[model samples]
Target: MLSLQQLSKQYKNSELALDNVSFDVPSGQVIGLIGPSGAGKSTLIRCINRLIEPTHGAIYLDDVELTQLSTSKLRKQRRRIGMIFQEYALVERLSVMENVLSGTLGYVSFWQSFFRKFPEPLLQKAFGYLERVGLLEHANKRADQLSGGQKQRVGIARALAQEPSLLLIDEPTASLDPKTSRQIMRLIKEICKERNLPAIINIHDVVLAQTYVDRIIGLKAGKIVFDGSPSALNASVLTTIYGKEEWNTTPACEEEVSIAPVPNFQTKLELAI
Candidate 1:
């Protein structure tokens, strides 16, 4: 459903975030993008969404040239794509229902959304989505009151509210514990299967990706080095993608450990330029 051809993103001062990266996310398939830090997994996904403009090449969503679209046209096109962020990206002061309803803002009238006035059917759909994510009881609670896992559930519900044909997830389980991460991964996989949605997710956790996605695409310095099923992603591919022998080692607790000098999500905005 999505095709990226010879994509490249070069920032100022000659920094190359993506170097002619190309790949495809076929209809009804769940694909995983995995690599170590600074390998450009996130960059490629952003480029596909036009969240960051590609320095070169074309991005086609169902054969529609997304890179050539005007801002207004891009907004309309994005209504068919749903994104779930690592941070959950919920509005802290808003109620869970309000945040889920925000997903439909892409479809709702400006005046109705501005006034937080959702139609009854839309509200009912939002309620059903919340229930699906096991968050029905917390529908009226403020986003800030929910736990990390709960907030991510709300994020999933928000994305589902869009009823998208394509899903883009950026480290969807990054902040949750292992057990919670597994639960979230299973939820995402199930959602894609049940809804027949094609998805591409950037994940640092190799085990989770292998366990959940139908295929794995490994990136290294913004280039695709591996594209195949999980069983085909051997040590050599991991070494090429991560540029580290450690990443090729057995699945260890280190992948779960948080990074020091934590990365700045705001830096991604810099990456766009």
Candidate 2:
């Protein structure tokens, strides 16, 4: 389980990207962090991973206190937390398999990683994840050679290769088409269920989040204004989070509906998109 007690992030200029935010994510649960741009969703996740430091409060992952760990200890603990990015942060020049193997860099010696000499078990595990993500056939292909969806799949494979206990996904489907987005969402849901992995997905697509995630957390102006199941979301709530507007989550196409992401809801406090 992951717990945040009064977590907050205030930038150098006195801007509060995250304002006393606090929440808990349990095992096997997928929490969709949704809000209009600048609601501090991205800041929250990055703070959890310590990519951005919180100005106050403590973060607990299971029995360990994440915010209290030293830099060296944090590096080791970070191995258990996987991050999936909006841009599909794969090495453009590396093959898919090699990109996936990069997830294990922390576990290997400097020389082993430098030489790309991972153990047989780690290699097999990477292959399994590649197959799990339906990217085994593209293992030898360069990350730059794949489509957006395929590149995201390789990112998924890489995160899985870490054997992470928790996943922090930032806009996983933002770059893909509607159909590919659904496929990716389904894949994420299935993987979470299969592994009992607790995940916090920073998503802009409320419809997709409603379709796949277990719970929804809505933020506004760096504060969590709503936390409930998807069924509980209505226009009134949407107004509360995104402010008053004509909100439509429905898709024009009956076959594959691709709703646009909520207007870029970032506070411009570095990157809380």
Candidate 3:
């Protein structure tokens, strides 16, 4: 559903953040991007959405060349790409429902958005997304009132509300507790599978990625070092991606704990429109 062809990025007067990173994402597949800090995980995600302009190369979503699009055309194209941030980027003063509805801003007129006057059908769809993310009851609550996990849930709902064909998630669980992180990961995985939406998740936790993602892509110093199934990510590969370090020892807490199963709300979500 998505393809990156020789995608490269370099900041002003800085070294290349991404180096000829190329990959393809099939429909309904979840790809986990893992690397150490400054490995260009965030850069790749931003480049896809044109949040940061790529220095060179091309990004294609469903065969549409994003790099060649005009500003207006890019805006239209972006409506099909949903993004989840490391920090829940919700409007603090807005209600959860309001925040979720903001996902449709690209589709609405300036005045309609200014007045918070979304179509009834879109409002209903937003509610359905909230329910899918287990946040229906908290729809009216202010975004600031929610906990970290709850805020992330709202973020997920908002992304889904876009009815996106692709999802770009940047450190979806970075701020949450371990258990909550797992739950969020599971939720993201399930939703992607059920909706048949391909996703690229920028995650720091390799263990968590192995548990949930369909495939893994390891980056080191802005270049892809390993690209394969989670089962193929052995100590050797991790050492290569993270640098020479003793990975044989597992943390005591990690060994004893397992990710908790999230509630099955798949049956309740009407993903097909």
Candidate 4:
């Protein structure tokens, strides 16, 4: 579990990126963080990971106050937080298996990792993660040879290799085509539930997020504007978060549309809703 209390971030120029934002993430829950551009969604994640220090307030992971930790302690705590990047941050020359194993670097000795001599059990675990992401067949391929979706799958597998307590995903579908984006979203949701792992995904596609995540946190100009189940994200809440637009206020009988592709343009119809 993670908690943010009165968290805020102000740049040297005194422009507030996150203003007194507070929230909690419970175990086995996936939260979709949605907002307009420059709404501080990315900033909040960076602050949580201590990549960008919070200008004020405290961050708690379990009972530990992350904001108060020493550098060495912070480094160790970071290993418990998994990160999946929008850019598919991978070593181009490394094989898919090696890339996933890199996630365990913090747990392994320097010489062991440098020599790629991961323990046999760890190697087997990496293989399991690869298979989970449907990349077992490509384990020997270089990262650069992967397509966009394959690369992101590798990214997901790498993050899971950390066996992290919480997942922090930044625009996991930002670069993929529409279908692939949906696949990645569904994959992340399933994995989080299966492992009882809590996750916070900073996402752009509102419909996509609403479809896959358990909850939605809407940000507006660096503040928490809406925090509730995806079903609560009616026209009014979305308008407040993203500014005025002709939103679909139709109270359809369906709660969440199934994510599978269908004939007669059903997938497109569901997305349009």
lDDT of 3: 0.87
User: Which candidate has the highest lDDT of all?
Assistant: 4
TM-score of 2: 0.91
What lDDT is reached at residue 88 by model 4?
94
Per residue, candidate 2 scores C-alpha lDDT tens digits across 1-273 of: 999999988999868888888889999999999998778889999999899999999999988899989999999989999999999999999999999999998799999988989999999999999999998999999999999999999999989989899999999998888789889999999999999999999888777788789899998888999998877777778788887765553334522433423233311111123
lDDT of 4 by residue, 61-123 (tens): 998899999998998888889999999999999999899999999889999999999999989
By summed lDDT, the worst window of 10 consecutive residues in model 2 runs over: 263-272
Between the candidate structures 1 and 2, which one is better when assessed by TM-score?
A: 2
Q: Residue 265 in model 3: shift from native, Å?
A: 32
Give the TM-score of each candidate: 0.89, 0.91, 0.92, 0.91
lDDT of 3 by residue, 128-226 (tens): 999999889999999999999999999999898888999999999888887898899999999999999999999987767887999999988899999
Q: Model 1, 117-207: lDDT tens per residue?
A: 8899999999999999999999999999999999999999999999787999999988888889879998999999998889998887776
C-alpha lDDT of all candidate models, in order: 0.83, 0.87, 0.87, 0.88
Ranking by TM-score: 3, 2, 4, 1
Q: Compare the candidates by TM-score and give the number of the best one.
A: 3
The positional error of residue 8 in candidate 2, measured at the CA in angstroms, is: 0.5
Misplaced by over 4 Å in model 1 are 246-273
